[model samples]
Every structure is written in C-alpha cells, then in structure tokens.
Target: MIEIHAKTSAANTGSASDRLHTLGLALPDLRGNPYYVHHRTVDSSIYISGQLPYQDGRLLGQGIVGRDVELETARELARHAALNALAAAVQAVGELDRVRIVQMLVFVASTPDFGEQSNVANAASDLLIEVLGENGRHARTAIGVAGLPLNSPVEIQMVCTAV
Candidate 1:
C-alpha cells in the first residue's frame, strides 16, 4: 500500500477566512453560470461541480500531464481547481468558515505511465487544510483521466457540510 504523505488537519483551529487572509489569498467572487449552477445544497450538504483551473476566466494550463505538462504544473493546476471548488462552496453556503469539507474528487489528465496522480492531488488537499484548518480535512480520491474538458491538466469536484 502507498503511504499517505499529505498533511492532516485534525489539530487545526481558527477561522478559515482568517487563515485564507494569512495565506495572502481570497476566494474569487464568481458569477453564476448560465448553463448550470456551480453548486447545489440539500439540507446541510453542498455538492460542487467539477471546476477547471481557471483564473480570471482563463484556463491555467492545458495538455496531458507527463507529456506537454510537468508534474509541478499539474499540481498547481490542481490547487487552482480546488480554489474554484471553494468558491463554488461559498456561493452555495454564503460563507467560507461556515462549512467543513467532507470529500473531494480530483481528476488529472495524464499519460498512461503517469503514476504520480496522488502526488499531484496533494496540492489540492494541502490548500484545503491550509484555508479551512480541521474543517478542511476530508476524504479524497485522485483519478487519472485520458482527457479533461478543455484539455486542462486538472479538475476538482467537492462536497461540503455546513456547520
């Protein structure tokens, strides 16, 4: 079995927003999409759709990882996608600190021989814990895909529970 090297947030505390500020980051104020809603809430649970690595409405990186893109680039793209997921979560619940992450699904477009999918996914996991502290720790899955929408390197979908 592969060892889990990602940081755990079990002992973390404090406001998620404050942690975000401390990290020199802010959630992007995203507008609602015309085709589909970014997230939906059923009771206390929020389901966020797959989000690409878009910053200011532009895809961050394209092409399959381990081919045209490097591992570090894919990792950063995952981080950005995770940020988009957090944005959708805030849009659904109206507050960042009011929710706790429950699960995350990370998709990486990579080559057949690329076995570092988990390593690329760690960037997203690390970002969540950094921003949400213990609330951000979650169950997660990393998937290797033949391709992704827009040929982007990474996409992230998430679930959160309002606390």
Candidate 2:
C-alpha cells in the first residue's frame, strides 16, 4: 500500500509560488484572457476553475488509471492539475503567499476495478503541502468517475482565502 504522508509544520520558507519554481513546475496559461478569467474572487475567498492535466495544448495522459494508465502517471497528472489550480489562484490574487488553501476537489477517471482513489489524489495534496506548508492543509474530496474532460486522468479544483 502507498503511504500518505501527514502534513508538516514546517517554517514558512518562501511563498508557494516560489516553492513551485524551486520544484521546476510552471503554471499553464489561464483559460481566459484580459476579459474573462479562470478564477474569480468573492469577499475574501477565491474560486479557481477546475483544471485538467493539460500542458501546451496536450493532455498529459488519458484513459482510466490502474488500467490504461499507470498509478504513477495518474499521480503526476494530478500534480499537473494542481499546478494549474495554483496558477489560477496566483493569477487571481497576484501571489501564492496571499492565499490560504481552504478546500480541494479532485476528480479521477478510474477503471471500475480501481479502488485507490486516495492514493492518486495524494499527488496534488502532497504538492500543496510541500509548497504551502501548514496553509496547504485543507478539506479535500477525492472522487472516482467514469470519465473526465478530454479523457484526462485527473482534474482538480480549489477554493482559497485571499488575504
């Protein structure tokens, strides 16, 4: 069984955005431009649009995880989707340090026989924790679905408190 690491109470080393850069990950372009936006703010909260594991107009991997896709590959896709979500949050609030993750909703495309949804979802959860430390700890929901947009293996959405 894959082990899910507990959240760490590490010192605030740097902004979440900087941590992402240190990890050698880049956020994709926002879905909308100057007019429409991929994220929106209401009061002190920011709502990020669901993001797929797509980069440079290409889906990272497709098909059901544990069947057509390997568990590791699907986990990577989840991380990618999380990066997109972080990018949207940054774009909305101008910096990752200004936002505190409140909730995360992860949707996974899986074969009927696949039952390790939490393990797949951990990729995103772990990334956020690694980047934001304590602030990364948030309510999460991992759901297995029959399919996803573009048949991508994972999609992620987030809600944050913009400070």
Local accuracy of candidate 2 as per-residue lDDT tens digits, 51-77:
888787677888999789999999999
* 10-77: candidate 1 lDDT, tens digit per residue: 22555788777777788876666788889989888999999999988889999999999999999999
The Cα local distance difference test for each model comes to: 0.86, 0.83
**Worst ten-residue run, lDDT, model 2?**
1-10
Error of 2 at 80 (Å): 0.2
If scored against the real structure, what TM-score would every candidate get?
Answer: 0.90, 0.88
Model 1 stretches astray by more than 4 angstroms:
1-13
Q: Highest lDDT: give the candidate number.
A: 1
